[model samples]
Target: MVMKNTESSPDLIDLIFKYIEEEFPEVQDRISELKPTIRKEFSGIETYIRQRSMTDRENQIREVMSLFNGRNATEVARRLNISRATVYRCIKTSAR
Candidate 1:
């Protein structure tokens, strides 16, 4: 026997995850206008958070690399607990 979906559209099956979006006020305007399923809103908000986190991490890597006085990439990466590829990429932009 199959259960019927009543809250949402019959054609679409949505997995609604209830969480606190109130804490993130900045995401309000971005997702509020969305007419599609709330799932898409969650995806948009999540993407924003992820991108911001990546940006913050990159900035941190650059700062840490600066304190290294432009030393070996491997050592810097090892100390920072990041990958050699990441360190090498940051080295290009970071002050050598």
Candidate 2:
């Protein structure tokens, strides 16, 4: 059995498989050879994206700060079209 991204929630994996099934129907039979190679590429990409997400958070903070004349959580939430709690959690978690 090949390992998949541990952090990929089940729904995401399902969606990915759905996409693959649609885009590359040939993978269904030769999954063993395909999964490992794809998994490695995906893992590298996931790492890069995680690193980039941190940079994006800083940019998000800057944009939010500019929009609200400072980092006003509520305004940031409104601008982002997300809940206030989500905005708070994103800012707090991204701090780490």
Candidate 3:
């Protein structure tokens, strides 16, 4: 998934607006009135949580990659149940 920085984030506030607009159009005015204050409070917390999650996922993938020694990309991919392309990308990324 593509990560969004704070300036570009569309977190729970956006979701609530969308849900209100789609499912309860009659309440649209009320939702819009609440969007800013709610977004200001939640977006920072949401972005921090997302960044940490990405770091954790990348570390886990790195750990999985470290378990293989001199294995071909295809073999490593199969062992890890990931695509060969992903394995190759990981190897290239880790090298840098």
Candidate 4:
């Protein structure tokens, strides 16, 4: 036996909207207004991640430098898997 679809597109949409309005009344205004802020929210998260990455890099460099007794920059860079230039830069920045 074949079944015919009784609901039209508008009818289905109306039913969905009514269900949403009843079940989620708080977000009804956001749904109707539709002012998306996804990019703004994600940009804030990206900025936070960037700042955290910088802080972590600085801390790692400081720890490596502190562990340096009489090791050369090349050895320190090899041990840390960073460039010798980065080790030198960290040393230069930390001295200031």
**Candidate topping lDDT:** 3
Q: Write the per-residue lDDT of candidate 2 for residues 1-96, one digit (tens) a residue.
A: 987776755644456666787899888776556666766666645332264576776777656545554357787788787677867666665557
Q: Against the true structure, what is every candidate's RMSD?
A: 8.3, 7.9, 8.5, 14.2
User: Which pairs clash inside model 2?
Assistant: none
By lDDT, rank the candidates, best first: 3, 4, 2, 1
Please report, in order, the local distance difference test score of every candidate based on alpha carbons.
Answer: 0.58, 0.65, 0.72, 0.68
How far residue 22's Cα lies from its native spot in candidate 2, in Å, is 2.3
Query: lDDT tens string, model 4, 1-96?
Result: 986676643443356566888998998887554323533344434332253577787897787678666568888888889888888888877878
Clashing pairs for predicted structure model 3, backbone only: none
Q: Residue 23 CA error for candidate 4 (Å)? A: 26
Candidate 3 accuracy as lDDT: 0.72
lDDT tens per residue, model 1, 1-96? 987767564322122211223565566565544426555544534232254576787786666667566567677777888777877667666644
Q: Write the per-residue lDDT of candidate 3 for residues 1-96, one digit (tens) a residue.
A: 976796777756676689879998888778757887787766657343353576876875686578657577777777778787777777777778
List the candidates' TM-scores in order.
Answer: 0.42, 0.39, 0.45, 0.44
lDDT of 1 at 88: 69
Poorest stretch of ten by lDDT in candidate 3: 43-52
Best of the two (1, 2) by lDDT: 2
